[model samples]
Target: MEQTETPPPGRRVALAVLGLSAMTIMANATVASSLPGLKRHFADVAGIDTLAGLIVTLPSLAVVITAGLMGWLADRMDRQKLLAFVALCYGLGGTSGLWAESLNAILAGRLLLGVGVAGTMTLGMTWSADLWQGAARARFLGLQGAAISVAGIVFMLTGGALAGLHWRGAFAVYALILPVAVLALLALAPYSRERRRAAPVAKGMARQAGFPWAAFAFVGSLGFVFQAAFYITPTRLPFRLEELGVANPLAVGALMAALVAVSAPVSLAYGRIRRHVSAMSVFGLSFALIGAGFVAHALAQDWHGVLAGSVIAGLGMGLSMPNYTTWFLARVPMAMRGRASGLLTTAFFLGQFASPLVSAPLVAHLGLAGAFGAVGGTLIGLGLLLAVAQIWWPEQARPETAPAAVS
Candidate 1:
């Protein structure tokens, strides 16, 4: 039976896709509350502090390597099946740390977890673009972003409580994602059969145009910078709290949750905002706010300042998430959405993986506060320049609407 080119998302399909989106947050930050304890647990090992930090960010390294490939596969394969398989990988790999006896073992599990992330996130987004266009796409992505932030809030609180019990306990939360694999398979079964008949057409369309490398480089850079700067909150915030004399895992979780909490409303409002301003203008404003938030963190005397920084930065983050995805999708051809989404995912995760590597040395030399100040300063300058450029060169401000998917 021939499947319609792009069916409207039914409840199950929508849930499966959005559920996959939520896991992207759980993929990394679910363990954020445990970072300090993990460091303490592995204190005997040299450079364990840095290695422990990797537990949160290391899946990104795997995503950096595999997201492009996963994207490519999505264009050619049954994305529904692939997404389901990866969800299983996400569950198994994420839970491995729960039983890991050594830091190396845990890191190995993180790499596998990254592979799962590359597939789930990339394919979930590809499905979104496949299923919707224009205003519908924008609205769905906004809802998707909000769902992710809400998941982050839940996972942060859950992880923090788990970490308080035992650092390993936090890893168990990952197992909860196991059911998503079944959900994807059952929800997408009809699409899988329908899409199979359209495979040849998709393949033909894929070769009609060359990949847009230059355009992607610009978009990719935007994603990278946003991630690198934003990751400072998850990767280092716990230690920052420790320095400020708040060491409880639950407290760290609450603060991190607070950071994500504020982003939810901003994400929900993204559709309205996108209608009024260019994506570039939104990026400019978001970056400026994030920079200011970091500055607040740098000057903070207690957790109150951290809370203030989180709220400020969270708003920017909310704007940035939906904006980046929308901007990238606007440029992607329907046939090539998979590969493009994968590459964009890679760019984003590469920034995440690079964050700790870059920040560790900065923290070593400048101290955490000074490091925050320096990064905040750079982002603020860059944000202002982007804003000014958007005003002077309005042509670049307005994004082209995405090419409509073939039916």
Candidate 2:
């Protein structure tokens, strides 16, 4: 793999931006460890079970609704300013829970946090597309996944500890984004302005080429399924653990951390994995691992078995996430990266928002283990179908094109 050298402040700045991107995951997972606490605190609220779940899903819902518009703005506006502004909002919205006295107010804060997430996520990947190319791009995307996994462990543990003190304490983790906002302003602002001036016409040219609607749809659908499957752990596992006689938030955090911790190493190995397998094949393998993990979870009679299943699913998550973004980036032209990235973000989070709804019925009828078995079976079937399709239609499975331009 040829490494394409990027001009200017180089890998240091790129790494900083990537580090900031980890905050997006923190916003979601940090709250997971706090869910049990929140549920207890708001025990009087009607339908509290569903409302407690909303604390986690609301941000994703906001992301799904707003990411496309944010992406569109990224292509036409100043990305640095957009990112920094959103980072500020992310901190404020996420931390609003600390002072909010009512459930509705807290939900409002999560909604605002979602808007911030939509922009930061859309712009973060667009920046990667703009700054690097070839193997470096692939490596950076893998690093993005690694960073998110590492952040998940740290934030989940922090949130769990804080939740033990008070549910509001976990909300304080959102305040970390304030410093990240400052870092983005200092590191990314100047370079972003320079890039904007150099390629004022890139957006128009990209529009002229027409959006790759078919490719966007394909990637979006795949993202939806993968994310829904991945979300089953954070959204439902705490409750599942309770059913198996583990009610401690810290223990739940550790188990969830184990899942993401396994993912970190696998994500870092993604560049190497791509060396031996086509992106399509990698996708197939990811689904297979996820399915098998779910099956393991379904059959678990104890938390240890659940942990094993989580680790397996984490491997699938680590590989598939980077693969999805890398595959989308490769297919889209430079001008369309922001919008395309936004659509991908929307699809992924939409799946997150839908995970509970999709699984709750199964939880109601079949129990958690049975739900896992059902989802696992579906994913394994999907994986096998994709593999067979790849063999039968290699050309469609692996389309060739000139490398994306490094703007």
Candidate 3:
């Protein structure tokens, strides 16, 4: 028998990774929540309101362009060194909002900020997967999902408080996330690209390397749909509620929070679901529930309709989020993780950025009902493709009887 040493492990690495993951969520959420305040400051500098949302979302475009390239590079380089470099990018890019006086400057800062988010969310996962295995990997993923939710919760709460002090002060809070993420990674060593085994000569390993494509497609499409349905709702809801003679900002915030809150517990419980159900079935169920939520939102005449819809869809996302990421990591060789994940996260972010473009025209032409009705249709299309892909997955994952003859 050939001797193979296990990858590095210690409590320090696990906590560090978890802490890093947790801190990242807060940074992402805080920037988004504090955007309004930042806009007020930048509005004088940039002479724009429509473009304010652009500052926040513009990064996704950059992330889509960069994430895969970086991930592929990570396969051939040191991930921690890359993450450390990006953390500086995060801090510098994030802080630029404080001093940026021109629209162009803000746009440049936004692109950098996008790069930081991409590194933490995508590469961090790859690193952790490289470091852990079996149940621990599953546990860490679950915690990552929960930590992301916690960040959202904390950032929103903190943002509301800090926005009163100054929007710049609010943004300053995001700069802290980069250092914390780096330290946690340094101290904990959560992932293990350093110890990857050589590729085995499996009869169909080359073809097999494509194993996670369908799942990746599903996750990527879902990210875009999530952005469209979840994000567009808040902007549009305020208008729709105005049409109904309700203009209370407090009520709207409460309702939206309730919707997202629905996903947190369900996301944490994902590990339990995996033990009993096939990911294909769960993915289908998630899509169906999300579609139903869209339909409910389309038909909603009152707050109750939207609230009910969000709860249903939140449950779907909560259950499916970590599973999708883990599913991809599990099937690929450690050596290719950076490239593979870069592609996956890029797809996910690209979908997120594309959501508004894809759905806004429909919303404009058809009214909320017609526009959201269109979203349900898109989900059906994605879900159908996934269902078919599921049929082909088992054969692709079968153990290789012989090594591939790669020249």
lDDT of each: 0.82, 0.80, 0.65
Model 2 over residues 209-285: C-alpha lDDT tens digits? 66778877887898899888778887778887888888986687788778788988898888777765777787888
TM-score of 2: 0.90
lDDT of 1: 0.82
Q: Point out the higher-scoring one by TM-score: 1 or 3.
A: 1
- Best candidate per lDDT, number? 1
Q: Give the best candidate by TM-score.
A: 2
Q: What lDDT score is found at residue 16 in candidate 1?
A: 86
Query: Each prediction's TM-score against the native?
Result: 0.88, 0.90, 0.83
What local lDDT score does residue 200 receive in model 3, on the 0 to 100 scale?
42
Those runs of model 2 whose alpha carbons end farther than 4 Å from true positions after fitting are 1-11, 32-50, 242-248, 395-407
Runs of candidate 3 with Cα error greater than 4 angstroms are 1-11, 23-29, 32-47, 100-103, 189-230, 377-407
Ranking by TM-score: 2, 1, 3
C-alpha RMSD of each candidate structure in angstroms: 3.7, 3.0, 4.8
